[model samples]
Target: MLFVAAMLAARPGLSQQASLEEKWRALFAQTSPAAAEEHIDAVLAACGDSPAALRKLFACDSAYPQLGGGLHRRATTVVDGETRYDVEYVVRVPGGYSPVRSCALLLAAHGQGGSGASITAMMQRGLGAEVEKYIIVAPTLPGPRRYAGAAYQEQAYLKPLAWARLNLNVDDDRIYVSGHSLGGHCTWHLATMFPHLFAAAVPMAGVPLFEGSPYTSNSYLENLANLPVWAIWGELDQKGPGTLSNVHFCRMAAERLRQLGNSKFEGTELPGVGHAGWWPKPEAYARYLTSHKRLAAPEKLVHFFHRARHGRAYYVEAIRLARDELDFSRRPQPKLRVQPGESLAEAAIRTGKQVYDKSLFKIWADLDKGANAMSIRASGVSAVRVYATEGMFDLSRPVTLRFAGRSWTGGISASARCMLTHYAATRDATAVICNEVDVDSAGKVLVRFGPSGGGETAE
Candidate 1:
């Protein structure tokens, strides 16, 4: 209703007003600048007093249409009760946008307390389309959010990223992520969180991952090493660099992944890239993304995107269930179905960053093409849920549920010996259940989640 006025308007004056400016500009070839100004004045009067109508006199584009080649829109995505930001992005594809592959996704998150304006400043200073080669997404930021730890990236960059792909012809196989300072730290988490999602990651002058820092574990880096990584920081960065956290973390991470038999990862330490100086990310990060495909699957990439957009709860649980081999000897054939219109041919499974999960099920997610139906087999619990949808997952509501009725009272007890050989069910009281089930790993589930009987827990 707020925009109803513009929606109902005739918009007839736009064409007439636009041509008037064209005629005026043409006159500039033969007449004086004074004459052009006179015509401009005439054009304005013909258009009218309304702002939208008047813009036509100058041949200006409406707010949403880019003046040259970019996207422009303003929407309020309220995060916390007290915080709100203007999420903005500018899409510019030189030739045209494509999707089966994936256009690059760049998240320009800022350091602690820096406004979204500062992030935009960095992008404009050196990150415009000059030599850029990917789609850029700059999420709105609070002036005080930390680059490394502001939970904002998950909310801003991650979710909108899913929405972004919906409208643009983005390459599904190549979404990339980046940031600076605090953003650098956040970028680290992004790379680690769903290591398989990004083709590459670039964090500039980011605060280093200090020794013993809870978030600096090797698990994340191990996950990230599947692809190329480029890091930059000023020699003078004092926040965490005085301690060499930024430079050394990369060193330690590279070494750890190598020890783990990962040889595809690369790390760069700029001799002079400063802690907060404007960075040439388009140049460096661009090279990283185009260099090589990190050797993963499209399903993994889409799953990564799904996790980023949706919360990781279900995604994490699914990852534990994705592999063909579980810690227990029994291998369940249960598969996870992505919502309709998701990608296919998923990537290989990779490790993800870890913290603490007090819940019985540590929910996890990754894109999977090989999985026919996704299910879980745990120490005390086992479950499954099919997405029932197709390729190119939509994580906004990325899940569905399925349940079966069998009353033996309590399901898998915390002490029950439950293993999914292919399917699992139990019909007797006080026992691990493996009732009427087919344990089809390659069978597609029609929903995303299943049942919770007595003593059954999935949260």
Candidate 2:
């Protein structure tokens, strides 16, 4: 790993007061555009000073409506039991000090050969000072950005945000996050490990979620219901192994979020760009920062829709993939409509429940003009628990419902609700009620129920 060693050696030589922005530019010239961002992030990590010293030296112009930012270095204490290292961070605060205002935070973790420097540079110049209205903290991640303990490294950085604020005046509501490569890996760790922490995330060219629990990490990952995230990848980048289901991971993640009724989930596969394309489109990501909004970036809506739709579709497909008997078979070109926020998973969990916001579903019963339909079968349900709004209920069209009874016939019909449920899965198909309807049989005879009232009939 001499290559890795040389990159880490580039650090100690970095001046404590080297220009964060200038170094970023030079890094761009010295390294491939892809590695430059991480390198710059590395420089930032090496520039740590004591917290008290930083408080005095940390200076900036007042954050204007969209004009504010500068190089700020600070070292905060990180305590994990008795051992504590001075974790450094370079911040680009959007605006200057003002009255109490809500803030969004973008916590950038550096990859191997990089530190807070490049991450800091990215926050300042790439996204610009107008982005400073919110605080962007880039921490110097450990071990030259190694994968081992990355999840803990992420959690280590995030824990102090609240604790640091307990002594300061940091706002807790508007934190947003993202990272690239190894840092992106850390971002994934942080987001899922603590999904309750962010509004949205955009992970660029990082590893897909792996099961880190049982052996090392404390737990395994379930489909998250509270967080909405967007993942990004370069189609050709293999240095970080971006080819392994990275796009599919984001797509599936978006689908899961949709199942939670959150249509805001997003992911994008940036064509032709590799791991280092952050510079070319950094501005496109500026708005998700929670403090600044870039009106000029067009990709915002485009990426948003891509992930949302893919996420919605995936959640719907998962039920069939679960293959709960019904002798399920695949169909070509299944027509499933998308309700506003319904991710594939969120929709499936809502079957047979009350819906306050009808906007969050792709109920097969809702299609007015579509000519095709879907069918399902169920056996038994130990406990048909509705999915908690803050719980997993990913659903979409062509959904499969599980209930009790001998496959009933006679043109029966039903719809989905925003409510989610957990039908204790088993090998026996005789537990829960299953939805069964074919394309031609879809619109003809309809029986349904509503939140306002309930009635059953044959259409």
Which candidate comes out best when scored by TM-score? 1
> Candidate 1, 370: how far from true, in Å?
10
The Cα local distance difference test for each model comes to 0.41, 0.40
Give the Å error, residue 217, model 2: 12
Best by lDDT: 1
lDDT of 2 by residue, 253-280 (tens): 5555556565555667677866675543
TM-scores vs. true structure, each candidate: 0.49, 0.44
Cα distance off (Å), candidate 1, residue 363: 8.6
* Model 2 lDDT, full chain set: 0.40
* Worst window of 10 by summed lDDT in candidate 2: 420-429
Candidate 1, residues 1-459: lDDT per residue as tens digits? 211223224245444335444533343332232334445444334434233443222122121111233444434353644666555543344344432223454555656666455665665555555324555666665344544333454566665565454344344456666777777776766766655456677767663342223323343343443556666655555555332345545555556767866555555566654456556656554566566543432233212211222222212324223322212222123244444543221100011122211111223224433333232323212333322222323222322222222111122211111111110111111111221222223332221122321123332
Q: Number of backbone collisions per candidate, in order? A: 67, 63
